[model samples]
Target: MSTFPDYYALLGVSKTATTDEIRQAYKKESLRTHPDRLTKATVEERKVATEKFQAVADAYYVLSDPSRRSEYDILYRTKAGNKSSDPGSSQNFFSQFANMFAGASTGAGTGAGPHGAMPGHQPDANGVFADVFEELLRPEVERVVPWWSYLGAACGAGLGFIIANIPGVMVGAYAGNRLGAIRDAKGKSVAVVFLSLGGSQKAAILRALALKVLGSAGM
Candidate 1:
């Protein structure tokens, strides 16, 4: 039997928590644990974030549905009761929903990235990042003022996430001391490595940075 992750624990929620509470937890955790948000982190850190983000999504998906949540609650209770004697026992919950959670892990179930693509098949990192950004920000934007025009902002955010996290592209203090830099329109000093971008790409990066900053500030 597969090890069933503690869905409530993963979401930082309780069995008695309300739907809205679970959702709020999911959104907050998703923002924090999203792999793109950890671009500057080490590979090990990124891996942990990826797994955590996936688990958060999984927890939300199961608990949001009444029937699924009921099934999970039973298993969770069983595991808790049998924890001491059979420390290795866990429901086959993972196997039953492997495909569903797997899709979420790959950025597919959320429709943030390409759909209908096989698992582990990421043909274009740029497109993947772009889609992920759009999906991440869509819920918040729609909540205030739903508009298609926001797609432009999402595209820019996606590109920014990718460039900011690109492997070997260090920034902040480390890069500040070594790479030096050029200032963009926003007056933020961009690393020299990104000087290759054209005017349009540069603008997109800046726009993304601005949106990210505002979003984080709860604007």
Candidate 2:
């Protein structure tokens, strides 16, 4: 129903935030995005803050619920707009999603220079991973995702479970640090070369870090 979410933006957390980190993020967002805190803000800003607060709350609500998180995992993979019937699509999608969120390898840095859209911003044989990463943060129940960064979309990070709501994603998740990418059901290009995961715990970290990067970038 909304744009893709920046989970970190929603909760005011960082991309590398941990569970405890997210908890702290939720608390901070609860304070900042709260309607009560916007007394002097413009009516429009207050309304926006209210919405962001709700989004944060909703994300926290879901991610906090394990069962809900499983469902979210399923949804994130299965909801591909063009993926009509790839029985394995969900599994494949999660594999890729997990990998990309990891960011560059441990010592490797993959940040785009802040001069403004760099060489990667241009549409190419492979859609820019940075753009794809930015797109994933948008929170859309059902809609074509967006590419731009968000101002406060990552609050939903606190509610990571709600990000996809799929069950048993661990089954398909393999062990490795490899290229991360995205593609439509039709096999159109999306993104290539993201990050690799050490495991689920690492995946969580990467996911958090991705959000933080997007947030800091003001996406």
Candidate 3:
């Protein structure tokens, strides 16, 4: 029952594609979804593309590493299936836990990142973040937010922060405005601003594109 991904499809390459082919595919896709180059599009549009782009980044990040790629391949093949466990084997629960936790922080799982858990834990979290970015880019998914929701989270009021994080970059501006008043046509409601990297249009758009591509994939 293990779920598996057609890694070749993820990279837009055939299964017979060479290592260089994979690398080239990744590079081409990366440039296509670069966020900084998305000035013409709305913030939401850029975010979706970014999420798709991140998927590619993560896939390439793993596929490029031999050991990790092997592990990923094994995991993908058996992720939805089960096998007999070896009691006498050295691999144990602790080791498996360590593998899952890896670079993730303790608090990260309690309620961190997009998953309400740590990285590499729930595929859903990946999907959620990826969904946000994907929606941002798609012309059909223009789910814009009010100006207050983004900026008002800092207030003592019991408002929720709906702005999405773009990995290591600054928060967007939609999350920067004051928390109050009715929505205005001229209000700051751009999706890219919530990530705070809107000023650096080129870099932000590239990231958004990368992430969007990443989320479009299935594993």
Task: Highest lDDT: give the candidate number.
Answer: 1
Give the lowest summed-lDDT range of ten residues in model 1. 82-91
* Model 3 stretches astray by more than 4 angstroms: 1-6, 79-219
The TM-scores of all predictions, comma-separated, are: 0.45, 0.32, 0.38
- Candidate 1 residue 169 C-alpha distance from true site, Å: 40
- For every candidate in turn, the CA RMSD to the true structure comes to 15.2, 23.9, 15.4
Tens-digit per-residue lDDT, 90-153, candidate 3 = 1222234326434544332122344323344422323223323443443311223343544443
Per residue, candidate 1 scores C-alpha lDDT tens digits across 118-177 of: 332312322322333444433333333222234434444455456776432333334432
In candidate 2, what are the lDDT values of residues 18-42, reduced to their tens digit?
Answer: 5556655554454444444333578
Winner by TM-score = 1
lDDT of 2 at 25: 55
Which residues of candidate 2, in runs, are more than 4 Å off? 1-9, 12-18, 78-219
